[model samples]
Target: MVDADASPPQAGEPISEQEALRRLRQSEDSSQQYYGAWWLGRMRSQHPEAVPLLQQALRQRRPRDSGDGVEENAVARNAARALGKLAPAAQTAIPDLLDTLQDADDGLREAAARALGQLAASEAIEALCEKLASGPAGAGAQQANSPRLVEPCEALLEALGDIGVNEPRVLAVVKPFLEHERPLIRSAAARTLLQLSGEARWGELLVDLLDHPQLQVRRAALMDLGAAGWRPGFQAIAATLAENSLKLMALRGLVEQGNGDPGDEALLACMDALL
Candidate 1:
């Protein structure tokens, strides 16, 4: 729901709010239902029935094939995602989303975790912590000591980070992921720890990731640092191999987090250099 660059659903032409709701409920076309749910969230529809309708969709268990049998994405995934965009209003969805955390489908679990995070459901903190109990990944372990749900675990880390929980358990659950085999997950851990602890070591780990062999990892590091609002990450972000525009975007985020100080001319100089 909070994805900065996620494209709108391409199901079909736009329709009136009533039409969208009608399709979601009474229409025979399931794809139309999916699009309707997406539209409601994209527009943040204020209709009283919007939240309830989406919740029903989230509870639905149907295979989503794109008119072809080749793909198997679930309709419920999008429904859950839409609810995240309509949070507080969607507070009724907390228990349902929690149940989804244990759902068999990895995609569903990932979407639910992301939604719970966007809603800032503090009640979800304990439930999310359980998924991360992978026995910890030490710098020497080379991999997680216990197996973890690959993408789902990463999504869980991202959710906890976004929730901005300051409890010791939140920090404890995430710190071990610094040694995760994947760079994005490692940086995600660093991002959360940096935000929660304000520790330079975590930021330094993110800085180290700027030079990772994988280009995607480098980009993830840039955005993670920006989201953490660590002012000192500017130089490393500017030096990363991502597109010029993203580098500037990252620098702009750091500037917002930077405290006003005429003495911090060097930071301003870096922003000027990016220009």
Candidate 2:
């Protein structure tokens, strides 16, 4: 929770790179630390020197609740994310970030995976695949943002895709997630598959998933279809345009495929039905 009033400076406001770096090193409060990390990434993170500072920030941990384990270190997580923005410049941090994959904090693990992908550190692919297959480290925690902690499998899947690793074993780990009971997981799996495979069949698979009983699953399918610019199932997608919970997702898919023309009688009919 960064309080806007207390935050260092808004995005457009001018701040010196040296000052940002100084704040990043000097800030003791988590919120301030997060703000500093963000500014550093946005301003001059590409500089090689930013890597060590960001790594040090990631090493700082907040007190943990022994009863219900959750890493309360927003600062470290933010720093990890900052390192990700640095990309190849942060390549030196790969080994340390790799170790972070086993951290008990789901958010930290997600951040580390994101950094690895950004760096395109192919060496970490096998370790990430193993984590995806075994499931993310630590039990789920009730974070303010979500009742469920960040799901590491999805993060790992996305990371692998970002790094352009399309190995059969990687595919094998991700394939099973498509049938996961949770729609969010199913959605992440679907998106990652499309990103890695770029196969029309995967898009078609998402189209089929539009018929799933859960609105969450249907939403995920529609979103992926839009991303792929898939047109084969516009009819089924149009039908969902009338569903309150799925309406936006369905419309987004139609729009992406340029199916929103007023002259298209079927699409107009679907839109009219919504009225």
Candidate 3:
């Protein structure tokens, strides 16, 4: 029943509410459906009516009898992401979004978690906690794996952090993952822990990550510590103060910690050298 323009809107073109609504009905092509959902999410602030349409898209299932291979799940997933972009305004969709978190599709689950986070859906915190504990829904190798299974897990953890559920119980739930073999997951856990507890223990854990061989892991830790005003890692962060790509984050961390050498002198000298 959904319908939209057969052709997509021109790039950089500002689509009106009517046009976006039209796009959401583009059921013929999954790609068109995706674009419609994406644009609707992007422009959701201007058109609150698009929210229910997006939820409808999320509810659609793949046509089993369709000879043409349409990615119905993908369209639905995009719908979920668009709802996430709609964010706190999309709070009315939380029940559906939370249900999507348990979807068989890992990517869809991630999108749902992100949407809940944006809404700051505290009602979903316990569910998010359980998702982190349970890992992704799968059989065989996925159950025992760490690095191989990253999507929804990382997404869920990041969502929990964004939702600001930093309580002792939540910290307890997130702590064990600090030792995860995969640096990416470890970084995610570290970031979440920092957001929740900001305890010296988590700070020290992040400090150690500065030496991580994976640049992404190190960057994640540095960014979190810097933004949180975590001072425990100042020395470790200082070591990277001159490295390219990481220096600015390092400086941010140091500046936030109030560890600057009493004025614009030392920090400016370092900046000049780095630049």
**What TM-score fits each model?**
0.81, 0.67, 0.72
For candidate 1, lDDT tens digit of each residue in 141-258? 3324434444476678878987888898888888778766677778888888887777889889889989998888888888887777788777788889878777776666676754
**What is the descending TM-score order?**
1, 3, 2
Better of 1 and 2 by TM-score: 1
**lDDT (0-100) at residue 79 of candidate 2?**
74
Judged by whole-model lDDT over C-alpha atoms, candidate 3 comes out at: 0.67
| Higher-ranked by TM-score: 1 or 3 | 1
Error of 2 at 212 (Å): 7.5
RMSD of each: 4.6, 7.1, 6.8
Error of 1 at 24 (Å): 2.6
- Candidate 3 residues lying further than 4 Å off, grouped into runs, are 1-17, 61-70, 134-147, 222-275
lDDT of 3 by residue, 3-92 (tens): 122133346566676876786776666666777887777656447677888898988844333465644687787787778778666878
Backbone clash pairs for candidate 2 read none
* Position 98, candidate 2: lDDT: 89
Backbone clashes per model, in order?
A: 0, 0, 3
Model 2 TM-score, all chains together: 0.67
By lDDT rank, best first, the candidates go 1, 3, 2
